[model samples]
Target chain A: MSESDIAAAFEDGPAFVPYLTAGDPTFESSIEYVEALERGGADVIELGLPFSEPIAEGPTIQQAIVRSLADGMTPVRFFEFVETLAVDVPLVCMTYYNLIYQYGEEEGPRPFVERAAAAGVDGLIVPDLPVEEAQPLRTACDALGVDLIFIVAPTTTDDRLDPLLEHSSGYVYVQARLGVTGARSDVSDHTSHSLDRLKGYDLPAAVGFGISTGEQAGEIVAGGADGIIVGSALVDIVADGYENDLSVEETADRLEAKANELTTGITEQGQPRSERL
Target chain B: MSETFGRYGGQYVPEALMPALEELTDAYQRYVLNNEDGFMDEFRQRLETFGGRPTPLQRAEQLSERYGTEVYLKREDLVHGGAHKLNNALGQVLLAKYMGKERIIAETGAGQHGTATAMAAAHLDMPCEIYMGRTDTNRQRPNVFRMRLNNAEVTPVDIGRGTLKEAISEALRDWAHTVETTHYVIGSVVGPHPFPQLVDAFQAVISAEIRDQLRERTGALPDSVVACAGGGSNAMGTFHHFVDEEPVDLYAIEAGGSSLEVDQARGVAPNSASLTTGTEGVLHGARTRVLQDGHGQIMESHSVSAGLDYAGVGPELAHLVETGRVTPDSVGDDTALAGFHRLSQTEGIIPALETSHAIGWLEEATPEQLGERVVLTVSGRGDKDLETVLEETAERDIPAAPQMNVFSNPTTGGDGNE
Candidate 1:
């Protein structure tokens, strides 16, 4: 797979991007969960390779990380988890910068990106890696035919935005709000303004952060996002399964149902009601 | 103007914090570097009147007699809040006022920085809140009360071992949400670009005073300077003015909790000696020396002193150590306890447990290791550490401790009449 695969995932309609930590609860159960999302019509799947310190995540994802780490998840294990997946959608590994920078022998992101490319991973999203320090990683990804995605927040200025878009590939993560990653009840008013700011850029913008429900996803796509990204809310589902000791099949079915609901929400707003009729 | 120190120190935070960092960089250059609106003058005046600037540099006769070398102490313990923390806290809070920020927020491990920030915020009449780890709050209970007494809300972070690293992450999350109205006063000489430089600028007053006071008394710079390195604020403060002096040796003492051998299987480092044994990795917001496993996972670090329990050191300190301008050393928990007892007994000054790490290194060093004239920073007073000292002193057989058995059984004390 290449960066084009990720860009092409959004060509049909508004893409549904759902995230899950790779080894949360257990590694095998997580593989089932990712495949379930793909079956539910996910265009792109974000596989969170849990880092020890996930500063950008809120409580839900933080708890997911702790569970994944306790299950002995590491960089090598994450790649193996990626390779074990049977899904056909492009997989993007989302993690902090340290794991990518310190992956293999002889320092830097080259060795890690090389291994990730071989592991069937197509793109990367490092929340802690701002555009100022993203050059080396971007160069590595570009050389290996993988995309380096950047998150554009509501507070990102035009000077920062120019470089962010220049170095970005696949899609730009449009942070819907001003805070860390978590689920909120309502869609932020700032989401439209963020989409408006990115209207000039040619890259696809996937709105994330505080987006959970189908109504919220529909509202974001209606506000002009190319895709919708949800993490903490989905992780909340898995957390409920783990805490309540639900069967893997049961949890996987619930995830598939939720993903289908989100995708339906996205496609409903893909065109105007009068044209669809 | 540069954001990096060698290959270290850059903005590694999420993009949501980019504008705040850029704004802070501008403020730092204008108010701090250029003294825009006489900001430096106002900062210095407030430091003198409110935080008690120009702390004394006193020669320790007893320590000199014991070490067989002239020993001098930069008395940061004499500052109004009983530590070097107030210097940076006061500067950042006043800068926030200049930047028109309505609130103040900070994170602390030992509560010295939290108490100091709360006091500074109260003095400047700004609303303040602090994030402290649950472990730190439980150990340093008095400082929590002190912060509340100064009208600062103390929020206990109950995640990830509840230490300085987690508190910092939690505070960053808060700052990301409220950047338009809040200024996060990072406690140490760590974090991204302008933070390490900005906090160092506020803290460099220690070395400035030591340079003048030592030269006035001894007619020369000290042969060596020593301070404890948690996140390396005080160490950098003591070494800033003397960095270019070719003859002055700087020692950054770290806490060796039990041993330096990292438990890679469990992802736990028994010690907090990041400058001594850490590999290069990005943590918090900068690339620095951090205690990380082979697969790039940050390990949980331990230290007897709550202040020195962080897994990562300041990026500039990492650069300085790599460039050979500073030497890093580790002092074990037992040795630091002995240092605590010795200072309290002989010098009649109770040093904070964080400062005791540096004092502990004094005992292990040879006369040649510590030059003829050695200067060390008493980073804070031990008033807040009395309970911790009482509990830990009972566990160890420290020679200098006077009969800790009396307090081990509280009923034996003469407080029955009361």
Candidate 2:
């Protein structure tokens, strides 16, 4: 899988994307959970490379990251986890910029991007890296035939949006709300407005942040998102199972069921409003 | 005009904060640099009347006799809030007002910056809140009370060792959620672009005053200037005006807590010497020297003083140390405790534990190393450190400590020191 694979996944229809920390409960359990997502009809799987400080995440994902790091997850182990997963869909490595900046002996993004390419990872999503300081990483990802995805907040102005569109590859992560990543009970009205802002850009727009349920995912897709990215919703399931002392098979079953419900909603919507019109 | 110090500083934050940083950058250019709408003028005037600017540069007669040199103290301990923290806190709160912000938030480790920011917000009539680690709240109880007295809400962070780093992460999280109507007053010269530059510009007043006062006292600048480095605010302020002087030297003393050795298995470094033993990495929105493990995870840092217990240093200070413009050194906890007592007993001026790190370095240096004339910033008063000093001094065999048994039975009836 590569950047083209991710772009192609969105071309067919509104894609269903799910996220999980690479080593949330443990390394072996995480691989099974990711494979379950693939079986549940995921188009792109985002594997969180847990960073020590995840400033962009809210309570749910932040707790998930802590659990992952406590399990002794590292950059080397994350790449090895990526290589071990059996999913055929595009895999995106999501983490903070420090892990990417301090990867190898030499400092910069190239060494990490190079390693990601070699490790069979398809894309990179750095939540803490703004578009203004993303040129080096953008160039590196482009050179290595990987995709660099940028998140677009509703507050992102034209000055920032222009550079973001120019630099972003694979897709643009359209933030569904104003705050950090978390599971919200209600869908934000800002999702449609955010997608409207990205109408001029040529990249696929995947709405994320606070989209927790099948109904919310369906509403975002029906409102014109090219895809829907869900994180905290799925991570909550894993955390609940871990706390309840559930077996790996039980947790993986819940993940697959949740992923199926989300993808079923997106598929039931048939097509995005923009694609239909 | 540039946001970076060499290749060190940049705005490495989430997209949600980009707009806020951009607005702050514009304000920083107009009000801070260009002084538009008399922003800098009002800032200076307020600092003078409210913060008590131009703190005395007193010649330490006893220290001069001990070191055989003309040792001077930049008396920032006399500042209104009892530390140099107000220089940046008041400046930022004023800047937030100029930017039309309605609320103020900040993070603190030792509670000094929290107290300063709280006072600034109250003086300016802006609603304020401060985030501090739960561990710090238990230790620095008096300063926490001072912040509450100023009417600022103190939010205790209960994650990841409950220290400065965790407090900063919590503050950043709040700023991301409230960036539209609130301003985050970062306590140190760390963080992303505009913050390091903004905090440094406000703190530069310390050096600016030091240079003028020293020139008024003598005819020339001192041969060397020394200040302790946690996030390197006071050190940067003390060294900012003298970086161009070819003859003057700069020293940044760090807290060498139990040892310099990093416990890789536990992911902890027993010291907070980022400028001396840290690797270049990104932390708290800027790329700087960070105490991290081989896997790029920021390690837990420790210090006797909460103010100096941080895992990362300011980018500008890291750049200066990298370029050989400033010398990096460290002193152990016991040595700093002795220095704390040495100053109190000899000069009748009790210094903060963080400031004592610099004074402790003096004992480790030779006469030639300090040169003929030396100046150091007394960053804060030791009132906030009385409890910490009492506890830490009791555990160690500090020659300078008077007598631990004097206060051993405070609750019950006890005899005098005699």
Candidate 3:
């Protein structure tokens, strides 16, 4: 899909991408969560491939990962679930490099990129695979017609930006904050500056890393971001409501309600959503 | 900066961290490597005034008698903080200060590195946080208290068997969010490019002094130089200098927890012997010998010494071992403890459990293998290990595991020396 296609998916505003951790609580719940996200008007679904060591995530997502792994989530198991669930939206596989490397079985007969592409994965984002060492995985991803997206942080230098943008596809992940991915009270102050710097690049951009509320989403869209990535806040809702002993349908209802609030906030023009909330 | 170790190191990190890593690499190059504007003087002065440089190479008369050779102990344990960990810690803290960073973060396994880092941060008046595996925090209690006393926040990580790798992941996560203000003081010669090389240069002081001290004692280099390898920092420090000297046999003793050999019948994971029997894989940013399952999932390593329990060996050690520059050896739990007791009884020196691996190897080495005048590095003191050693010795039955037949194996010792 082209950048314009992604832009078109988010009619009237920036794309609202909801990231769901696969196999949270149970494998079935993960599918249900994604379904609810789609109903709440998610333009793109970023499926988190839970890793044993997720160094790029904060406590909220880390706990989700721990829960996912406890449910016996492995690389092969993740692909099997993706194949079975078969979500209709643009599905992106997000995880650390080790999982892809392990699942790829570098020495084994088959690489994971092949298996993921065959299983209907649309894009790939290994947070730990730098542009310097992405050729092998990129080669395999290219052959399988899978888009390999790259992330550019606020701390990224001017010289390094071009290489990352050149290699990225299916919209680039522009980190608004300097830290790991988690919901913050407000978006980073440097978000506007980063977006302005990235404006020159032809690629469609989305802002992530600590983007919490609908107001924050609206601000990012106003700042020229093509999409808004929401992860921890949505994941945290499921985690917080988990102890209340909700059924699968009830869980999806609660999650969809929260997703709708975020979706509405992104489409509306105003200050960061936290202040409005 | 490229992440590779003579075909073993490469930067396999995320693009999000590329700018930070490159900036760090450039800072390291400008300040430490290039010694831009006399930066080395400040680093060296700190090592001298704060770290107590030129640690003694004490002659072990009783140990020499027992081993039937002249044995000299490179006393890194005598350095401030009671371990060689401070050498690397002090240098990194200096670099962080040079970078104008106010907050410092690090990951520790045995808490020695954490205490050393905390001490450096304290001296420099920087706020410090250390990520430690809960298991290690519980095992090495005194060091935990020491880090706290120095005002460093000691967070006990409770994930994935609660070990070093888990602590590292936590530190890495913390670093990702606060890349500009925070500096990570990685404790070993592992990880991405410049880190492995940077850490080794800081640690190479162990060998630099040994070269001078050994010549002063024996008028020539010893027949062999020995040190224990965990992430292989101290061993890398001790072995790196001797690699070019063909006749000086470089030996690295890794922890062999229950046994080095894998029990196919019993279906047990082999002890923490990475070079002995491990495949080449990427772990903790460096492509090195790692104890991984067939599918490349990192295996949990077992050792009596928590300091030597890592599944991955240092990349330089991996390359050196591959190129026949360093001979890899193993010392199991029971024997390492036995070596600990013997050192205390005979030499009046209570060696750290990690350091005892080298002492244990000496106990079994024939006169033919370990020639006259051997230098052993006591990487750290044993005060921190007394509780675990006493408890383990009290609770366990002593059934001695058979040592591997290393003498017959040409590949066991580096082929170039033997």
**CA lDDT of B15 in candidate 3?**
61
Runs in model 1 lying further than 4 Å from the true structure? A1-3, A272-277, B407-418
Q: What alpha-carbon RMSD in Å does predicted model 2 have with respect to the real structure?
A: 2.2
Over A1-277, each residue of candidate 3 has an lDDT whose tens digit, in order, gives 4443343454445678889888897888888888898888788889898866677788888889888877877778888778777456778899766667666535521388888888888888878777887887788876777888898887788898888888887788988887788999878777888888877776667788887787778777777777889999888877876768778888898778877877787777533322322
Q: Predictions ranked by TM-score, top down?
A: 1, 2, 3
> By lDDT, who's the top model here?
1
Put down candidate 2 lDDT per residue, B286-398, tens digits, no spaces. Answer: 99999999878999999998999999999999999999999999998889989999999989999999999999999999887799899999999999998788767766677
TM-score of chain A of each: 0.96, 0.96, 0.91
True contacts kept of 3: 0.64
Q: Is the docking of candidate 1 incorrect, acceptable, medium or high quality?
A: high
lDDT of 1 by residue, B304-364 (tens): 8999999999999999999999999999998998999899988999999999999999999
Clashing pairs for predicted structure model 1, backbone only:
none
Better-scoring candidate (DockQ), 1 or 2 = 1
lDDT of 3 by residue, B1-418 (tens): 4467676877766566677778779888899889987788888888888999989999999988878889999999998999999999998998988888879999999898999999999999999999999999988899999999999999999877888878988888888777778889999888877788889989998998999988886789989899999898999998778888899998999888897766533323457888887778777666788876644556777898988888888888899999988989888888898888778777888889999889889988878768998999999999999877765664444333122224454332232223
Question: What are the clash counts of all predictions, listed in order?
Answer: 0, 0, 15
As a whole number from 0 to 100, the lDDT of residue A239 in candidate 1 is 97
- Model 3 sits at a Cα RMSD from the real structure of 7.0
